[model samples]
Target: MVIRGAGRLTAAAVGVAVTVATAVGLVLTPSSAKVEPAMVADPGPPEVTISIALGGATHGYVNPDVALAQGGTLTIANGDGVLHTVTSDALGTSGDPLFGFSVPARTTRSFALPSLAGGAYGFYCVFHPGMRGTLTVIGGPVGEVPAPPSFDQALRIPKVLSGDHITIPMKKADVRIMADGPKTTMWTYGGSYPGPTIERRAGQQTKVTFVHKLPKDAGSMTVHHHGGHQSSADDGQPTKHLIEKGAKRTYTYALRDAGKPAPAAFNFYHDHRMHVTARNNWRGLQGMFLITDPKEKKLGLPTGKYDVPLHFSDRSFTASNQLSDPFGHAAHSGHGGMPGWMTGEHAPPNDATVGQRILVNGQYAPYLTVKPGLYRLRLLNASLFSAYDFALSDGSAFTQVGTGSGLLPAPVTRQDVLLGPAQRADVVVDFRGKAGQDVLLSTIPRSDSTGTGSRNAALMQFRVRGTTSQKARVPGKLRPLAPLKGVPGKVSKTWTFDLSEMHSGGQHGSFWSINGKMFKASRMDHKVRMNSVEKWKLRNTSDMTHYVHLHQEQWHTLSRDGDEPPPWEQGLEDTWRLDPGEEVVVAARFTDFPGVFMLHCHMLDHEDHGMMAQFEIVR
Candidate 1:
């Protein structure tokens, strides 16, 4: 069993009873550690159950954290106050198949591993990066599984916008996508990986119905429409409402009366399933959701074919060409300051999954054939764990036109722009005179890794082709931004992001905290009035990095620490990353959404572990 996400902790003692029992002809020794068997009146199946105690800085295994049973069910119970996942491919080794189960708060869950010829299996929380254990399967033949086919998609994936009212069916379909090799299987939506881009205009009421036609075992899914202010039901908060396999749900994004209309910006829709988000998204369950305004569109910017939405992500592939979790199966990258958690003894304080290869719009080092003119590129750093500092190979300057929120005050010429996970930027690249130049889109080293600029540097290539008659313009002023001073509510809350450790209960791992508390879904961390704007002070107390994200509202940065925010952050934004010990002040207003919303780290693994918290929006 695998548990994901963060929450409270617990402690318990394993029973000392010594009863040697046999189930399905498999010998079992009574464990010195505490554990419970199935509560069925009659022994239903050959199974071994492990009780997990989760609490402050601790994830305790009641048993030896190893097993000798063969071909049976493995049960795990979460006796904690938050959601968790038990992912068997915790080390992400190629020999082990990825299997996960969500152990909800204070609940027990089980999974069957019937064809188990195993040696040692490592399991960990998809959420808690540092919490892991090993389970040894003895008396079974150990062998390797067959490798998957190579995955290489040679075409440039385009961004598509859904119609005004569209019905999107979510089902398990195999898609052929290649990044650098042959075709590989991709779990997809509507038969396409990354699904299909859904585009909408501000003030337009769009109703989208998601039909879950996935296989019975594909697990539940929910599409979180980030950067939209609608309602709690439509917000797609994790662990709240999910579309079970064969089930369906409709979300209405009624921005018709969202109060003076938030800025039109680049948003995205991705799977936010409880406990299995990292795997789900890594398996190709994400897409672009762009919001546009007519006035901004009429500014004669790069439109139509010239306007490109580039989704950048990094991925690791197994020898068989299957998508593998870098967190698991990967060699511990000791780059930057990452805690070599893969092989190290203790959990690293905070770690991010950095991939070995980069993908641009689902293509590996793809070349974009562009005319000698200006093109508007909507850049999204969709990498699950990596942050990037993007620049041209030739070091030419590009103008940043917009941010994740919307249009900037003016275009800022920059030689390089840093993008953290889940962050977006709109850039204007001019290729008029550089027609024959093959410019490489390179990335700088991330905060978590050492300078890998030479290894996985270039993301994509821009092949300047024939000439085009299209003209693009960058206006001096894009739009008017709201003043932070007169925004409504007072300074309502302050959240501190930090690291905590649990040294007792026979458990040890580094965990993330907000205001010194781990994330608890059942607990509402804060509350706010609807339609009232409030200022939030976010302080990063940890010695690592965190990208703070708030759902439903596109807020404005009031200031960073004590000084004013830079031009890039002064617009409508949904996410921001803070360096260690850095403090930032941002303001947001609750509109029609009146329910529980989330404010958490966007470094998905961290959020899954414990760096996430929620607040209530009341009427």
Candidate 2:
């Protein structure tokens, strides 16, 4: 009998037959004609094999239900980059597992089910309770197996805190990403997943005191005011001014651009520890920071309740609803391939960590009720590695009025906005005539061929209801942006992003790097003259996409691969996406305070690895 394993089995068993025939000749003797009957051994029960794997984010298990003969084999394959298990639910208690065998990532295992009785049994993964399946035992050959809900929760806007002197406590709290999901423990700012929105007027001096209340093992914390023009002491360098556990540290922001009121902008604050930046941010120590210039009130954009800040991020949880370790064996390498280093050992610092679930404002596919009018949406991509191509479900256009640092000179109409990690876009979405309709804010699938991109498409929903008498329109001219002056054909410096092989602590692997060198705290890669405008060329030589981010100052994109930048990139920007082998030229005038600042990939995993460098501004 031949045993075969396939993704699906249409029939239960394969049959084997043996035929015996005796030929008699007329001239043959009786003794010679009588041939001994060939003895045949009986073939017992035929064995059937069923093959299944871990489906992508959307589908929990490829074949959730399957039938197998009483005496057959079950082959389990884990195609994902993460570790998963196939355990009988009937053998173990809720939290204490007593039965299932472990299956490492990117491996296959076979189990014999001959000893089990002819009945139905349930199974699940020990790491992920959400992953469950059913297996049935039949007396005969197994036949074909059979196959396999939406967002209705209200959006939870982060609590707003506005004052010159604000205090936020960093502590662990129990929060729920999905309305019906289990409670997840997260390291939050002021006990919230997104912390609190810190709103301040431009030109005002604000000081925020962060009290470190997380467990001692949480390590020292540093708060980075992303996109802020602050001094080196407050820039949140990995080793500068850390807030130790049970201690407090204050960060001061001038909120000014060279002694003048800074243009109204959207920024954010998050943890930026040295090697744990990715893990810290993934645990939820981030929030939105808004700088408002009273002068912009004349533009008449959406304000008050009509203005909304949507923070997008992706995460994965364990069976107990705790954040999964991005570098752990059970965690999925967001890059879609296995880590270059060993599993169950020290993590490969360069691997990208992508999550299975996408969230908006800390809620899983939540909904926001809106009035029939124009509203301003402040969009921020806070995820560790994923980049979202945001679009409306109805195929409506968004009037983009602002880039990363501040408002654009004019509103550019865009059908969809692509935001890399740590990038922000301010757009005006009009729902004027679409009352009583549910419009979903969804993301386009990633075009890159690296990893299995996010399966969750819908980020949130906009439930347009009620009527408003006010008519708001995006102005043709929103602000004045003076282009950075730079001499043509003169390049100040060029930075290349690539991957380099390194041997550290007896482990050898390829790590992300800038200019073929890993990050060194004592090394400075570039020095720029203060208040001098210079053009710089950025290049990506690696095989994967990268989101390049510069601290302290926002720059203007001069050209992308020798072509003018897109409408959304025409404004002052701090982060730029670089596909494999793509190059970009940008110009910026170094001003204000800049002692030692960082320039690196915004993908937190890449940043945490060695794909970062430091620069200094000299007078």
Candidate 3:
């Protein structure tokens, strides 16, 4: 069966209970009943400015954490183009301290911290889940220290869910995840970090009843069947059918094939809770969805244990071995709808939280024992940010087979395979006759496939074992893809990705926008004719990378920067990460079913920050 990646969630700081009103109620009167000037008090001690630096996917702010004195005024500058809030449950006595304090994009907000006992305090942006920091209130002189990741041994692979139809319960549980040298507490589904994999067959109907049993503080959830082309009601779009704590909803997928010639492929399912997606996913509310067909299987591709589904992601840990960053939960007044600007209506373009440790199936530097033969490796870039250019340390070439959506026209042999957030690639690793060999799977940093040079960082390892007579081979003629040279589609529309507002103080932080407008769920940015093929051009105007993803249907990448895409991208794809100032054209036919689908940056944080837009497919 084909495979895709899922998301995860974690826990944050806990302190006293309090509530604060974020909105100010305005009183109406006849000409505003002699509004008096608000009393201007004497300005207190000057604040120490802490700028929230935004850059790179997977790494939002350069200084996400900070240290300060116990009793001092603070100024936090939102250096990106998005709204943010610095709230700590450790602060305030009567209410949620974050309620009235919000820092607009490219602006700064100052606040006075009540004199407190010297200790550590955690803070985060209410709008962006992964945007978190630590405040070490030094009493005397010693400063605060940042927590490091917990890494350890390679454990058993993440559990895979079988059976054609099944019941998936989204529950609150805990699992010990080892990364670099230690095991950390990770919130999970079915007591596993990645939950379980769900498998199905093409042209077969499947029923999945998602039961939610998470605690109230864990927040509400809706399961999005990512990469599934189903009706709107079954799409699991946020706010459509949310299962609050203790509530359950069953989503049924007809699971028919798109009939696009490409072999059956894999996708993923995860929590799409309107606002807290980053946190919920960071807590591990995601799993894989697999679809099988006779065509690909008959080709004698690696099946069963030999065909592996690998999920690549990164996460950070607190000093106590608890999940930090995206794992921490923020206490927002409520979920859904547009938030106030000060609270950040959207996420900044550079707000993709990259973790410190790269994990494969929840294991740090995991080593997979593979038979000395051919193995079909399904690679899914499940990271919230971070695009990877995969290559073998031993200089072994990877035979490109297929992708998250389906198989390519033919296999392409190359050393490096670039995968962005939410993207997938299926490759055949020929380990034939090589026993007791340790091959390192590394990532080429900033390997955008531009004319620039590339750097390498080791990710995971492959330990080759005994040989097998059951030879798994890559078919000479895999599948046929449509010729992009004469693809039948007009350049009907164009979408440009860039900053909407340059924030208040001209800080580097800016809100991600399409066509110069922030995302609004109620707004329909585009309209498509049902079952009609159309080509859309995407232009990235920002200096950061943006992975564009379209829902409901997989698209055929026609060209990149007026040139043919890499051979690996010749087939259908649901997401493509574009570098700064890059332009690409893709074609898609919205068939089967379509209502209101989203087209957005796959950097989940960016999507949460208003970089997403909706389009309707009309009959």
Candidate 4:
């Protein structure tokens, strides 16, 4: 039993209990936790029995269609010919996989769901999306439900990169992080704390002669390309190999100059190692990959006179020690997050009160003075897992120009927008101002981590400083992005991910996993042909929402977040996010990878907590 995402602190306890029981073939019961008293409130309607079927021919049933109490429980039955797992992201349901009952075919399995409040919950099968069901808690005031994340109109802060002639020393330099500080090692690049930022255009290959720079280095780290193409050996993955301290290793990968034609939108580089990434990135070793295109330059979009690179993130730290990862929740990270953070009901705080630092391009409370004309922002969400909904301090609309697929066919003006764990949006904000007026650029507070809802807090601040020209105007159209042709009729092979589980303790913490397995460092699951296009249909059957991510391939979303494929998604990609209960159909052409690649949860903790698996691309 593994809980998929337990926002509740019950994750640690639950995980420990299940692991022991599995090994002994007996359930280990722990004393129920003492409950804190809550002032009473209005009751919700009785739940109706909603019968759902899993595995087309194999159907499982869940009774009591809806759960209305804050921490109520529901009983589910397994009636399918095959085994079934029931999981949710309700309050205490961390990404544990034990809450699930693995009833054999023809037998019945029962599961008791513990407490789920009034908001909508996401549930899915780790086996198949075709095997999905939803439990909508009704009887609440309409507005109480969070509004879906919107592209509400707002102003855009100008964008800028370290626009520099980047040079990775031809010779490898041994380096180490200085942890002998008041707190943990402040982040560093190359060798020194806060490793130097590298800036370059697309179509350029960065040659890195990597050398283990740490003394007694027991762990490994790699430079990950945050862009779409992640297949080449250059894409970071410790398992691929390691460069030892004092020994030099060269890694030369090309970056298509955005100023010319390119393979991806602007991207960034960061370390993706487990456990250590959160600490390293928070300390400031993250940098941007600025890709410019002649097509974009010709668009008459906001140019240098008004561009800004606003890297937004939320972090919590004390004057000396950065607050440790919340016992279970992952605030701003993709790896080593506890399963508890993914499925729990603990909504993230909206203000930066508990958190002490905010950096924009590596500087605290970064102040970038802007000109009054139209300012284009190359916004980056470099935080580990914190998501945001943003708008101008004063209500204003911002023109959206590009996203995962690059500049839309035209400039799209939207209100508030959703920036998920690793998603980005390029916008143009026109500041109609006196030369030195201050305009604060910020994001809203957010609550539910599963869906695009809730405004967590103000993500950043931008001040309008320089003079403006009345001559600036936002064109109705920016660039033309056509969708790629699909390989629909060719359904070579199909796979489904039914997210079910609430398991506890093992070597890794309890977590939500596909089938009944967590991510094992040495396991390889799927073997495929490189360059073969296939369809993967994903469905979320758990109460909590899971962000499913794939490595070595950035696939296209067939349908999701109300986005239908325009002419662009027809090509290939390396990542696609799947929301709960929502089915996303995607096609990918894996042209590389002689060995296995990984396809798992984007929620890093869930991946580390055993919510991951491997896929091999062979001959």
Name the runs in model 2 displaced over 4 angstroms: 1-148, 328-350, 447-456, 486-489, 503-507
Q: For residue 599, give model 4's deviation from the true position in Å.
A: 3.1
**lDDT, candidate 1, 50-93, per-residue tens:** 66675511434556265645556778776754444444431112
Q: Rank the candidates by TM-score, best first.
A: 2, 3, 1, 4
List ranges where model 1 is wrong by over 4 Å. 1-155, 179-181, 325-351, 446-456, 484-490
- 386-487 per-residue lDDT for model 2 (tens digits): 677788878899999998689998999988887879999999999989999988887754433332232225567799999998756777898887866664
TM-score-superior candidate, 2 or 3: 2
Candidate 4's residue-wise lDDT over 1-619, tens digit each? 2112221112223323221011000111111111122223555434333344443323324442354444334434444433233333222322222222233323333233333334555444332323445454433332121111111122233232233333332122222211222434444454332344344555655565545454444355566666635344666663565444445555555553213335446566666665444444544456565655555555577776466666665444333433333333334342244433333222111001111223344433334555667877877666554445666756678877777436665666677665655566778887765456544555543332334232223333455665655354566766543443555564444334443434343312224566566556687666777666677666665434455666655455565534675432333333454544565677666664466566665544445455566777777
Clashes of each: 27, 2, 36, 127
Model 3 lowest lDDT segment of ten:
1-10
Residue range 1-619, candidate 3, lDDT tens digits:
0000012111111111111112111111112112112122332334466576553122445566565565577676666644444544222211112112445446665666555444555554433334556655545322222221111355456666666567777765656555323456555666676778777777777778777777778767788888887877788777666777787777777776455432478788877766567667776777778887876777788888888888877665555445664322223432233232213322343244545346677765566777788888888888776566788867789998898998988899987887878888989888886798877777753433321111123566678887688756788878787554434646988989876654443333345788887788788899988877788999998755678888887688889999999888888888887776799999877777758887888777667666887888899
- Best candidate, lDDT-wise? 2
Arrange candidates, best lDDT first. 2, 1, 3, 4
Alpha-carbon local distance difference test for all models: 0.63, 0.70, 0.63, 0.45
lDDT of 1 at 18: 10
